[model samples]
Target: MGSTILPTGMVFASEQNITENSSYSSSDNVGVSIQKDENGDLMVVKTETKARANVARWGAWQYTHIALSTGVTAGAINTAYSKGIGSVLGIFGLPGWAIGNLLTAAGWTNYGNSPGNAVARLWDKNHNGWVGFYKRTGYDGAGRAVATAYKTE
Candidate 1:
């Protein structure tokens, strides 16, 4: 008698295989897979995605001078000069000149000398002292006054 061989149910099944008792599936998809390990724990696979970038904008400060008479208190100087200058600029849709006056009044420049004095000496005909205005040019790196002008003197 001659021995004979026979092929099983599925010839070359890539995903699943069928046996007489049980069946198994590959459970793998491209690089991703959904499968259980010997411990029967689920596992997931992922691919790298593009990262997002962030951006920021830069701005500059603007300043104007306020002129005042001598012997003016910093507060008074700020009120009279700063407010007036601010109001005038506001009319033209410009930023308040108060910031410049405040900075000058606060002694941020010239050893904290009265901004009023600087303005007065520079432009006041009576030399009675006045407030000065300065605007930042371009992006003020130090955030300080770049140029200054007086109310008329």
Candidate 2:
């Protein structure tokens, strides 16, 4: 007899018969079956399955970078504003000048120099400083996510 072509592109010749104890198995998330048609022809059946899993996505890296950069920029701006305010207050006299100097120094230490150094490191491209900054931000974001998830539980 001539070979019969199955819908799945498998060809079965009439002389070849499926054994009675034929079995099918799948290791993946799928189902497999072997059956016979009305004409005693072997048929292979397959069932497709989709497996779903809840996984942590790394899409927050971009946001983390943006946030870090924004924080640094805002720090710089705030420091400059405070310096301006301090300089204006210094014109008032001795105690005012002392307080102004204190504010200026605090602002420089808290916002200006520290954040400026970070920004410089981020833009230095010659060194791996950018990687360090990005990695720190990524770690911070991942830590926050874990902490928040734990708190909700």
Q: After superposition, how far is residue 7 of candidate 2 from its true place, in Å?
A: 22
What is the TM-score (0 to 1) of candidate 2?
0.18
Q: Write the per-residue lDDT of candidate 2 for residues 2-119, one digit (tens) a residue.
A: 1222233222222222355553332321333333323333333333223122223322212123212334433532443444433333232222222222222222234433444543
**Which 10-residue window in model 2 sums to the lowest lDDT?**
144-153
Alpha-carbon local distance difference test for all models: 0.29, 0.29
Off by over 4 Å in 2: 1-18, 50-153
Q: CA lDDT of 87 in candidate 2?
A: 33
How large is the C-alpha RMSD of every model relative to the true structure? 35.8, 31.8
User: What lDDT tens digits, residue by residue, belong to model 1 across residues 13-48?
Assistant: 122322333322222212222222223322121111
Per-residue lDDT, model 1, residue 1, is 8
